[model samples]
Target: MSKHSVVIFVSQRNSLRSILAQACLAHLGSGRFLALSCGWPGMLADAIHPAAIGALNSASMPIPNHRPRDWNDLARPSAARAEFVITLDETTSSFQPRWPGQPDSALWAFPDVAAAGDPEKVAHLAIQMLYALRRRLELFVSLPLQGTDRAAIRSDLRDLAHMR
Candidate 1:
């Protein structure tokens, strides 16, 4: 039997974009992929953002049951090795750590919705990000990963970043 491909979503903070991506992939991957998420070292948030939780609840997606984690935790030798590592923000994309198996990596580049002060605005941005992530993840789960080479898969994921 074939094993599921493991994908990790990363961001400056695991509170918003990465969390949304992770939840969306977990829902859309259909047993073909294992999804996880983390934030940069020293940058993990105290909790998943309330806006993010509301967005997921509104969309009927599952909320992750864990707090934001440090990216360094995933770098440990005992950690699950990722097949792909995707950065959801510009900051994380610029400083991603090397994965154990040198997973195919890409930058999805979602904006920081946490920066918005107004509760309504934050919720709006969160939902928008969630929908955007869901669209990309739908395309992602449709990729022919079984027979594809590492380079080709990487290119395919990178190409998805160009979609609006």
Candidate 2:
């Protein structure tokens, strides 16, 4: 049987881009990939942004039930070892934590939708981010992971970061 990869999408706050990526991957990757997400310590929110939830709902994606988590929480010895770690914002991309198993990492930078000052603008950005993330994830799930080496997988992921 082929191995199922655990991928963690990380960001500064885990309220927008990372949350969208996690939901998109979980729904799209299904049996092939397990999706998780986290943010920097002390940056977690009580809940994900409402715009994020609305975006997922519009796309018919599954909404995550849990609150935001700190990256340190996932770094624990007992935590599920991630095979892939992707950062979705500049802050998180600059702060590298030693993930368990030294997961193949990539920086898929996306704008912070939660930072939009207007509610309508926030919702619009969230939808845009959702579409962008879904496009990348669609390509991600189609990769020949079972046959590809770690280096190739890492390269492919980084290449996706360049996609709009």
TM-score between candidate 1 and the true structure: 0.96
lDDT of each: 0.89, 0.88
lDDT of 2 by residue, 1-164 (tens): 13778999998988888899999999998678889999998877778999999999999998987799899988888888998899998777777578888888998888777877899999998999899999999999998888678798889999999996
Instruction: Return the lDDT, model 1, position 91.
Output: 77
RMSD of each candidate? 1.3, 1.3
Please give the lDDT score at residue 38 for candidate 1: 96
Model 1, 34-140: lDDT tens digits are 89999998888999999999999999999998899988888777888998999988877767667888788988888888898899999999999999999899999
Candidate 2 C-alpha RMSD relative to the actual structure: 1.3
Give the residue spans of candidate 1 off by over 4 A. Answer: none
Worst 10 residues of 1 by lDDT: 91-100
Question: Could you say which candidate leads in lDDT?
Answer: 1
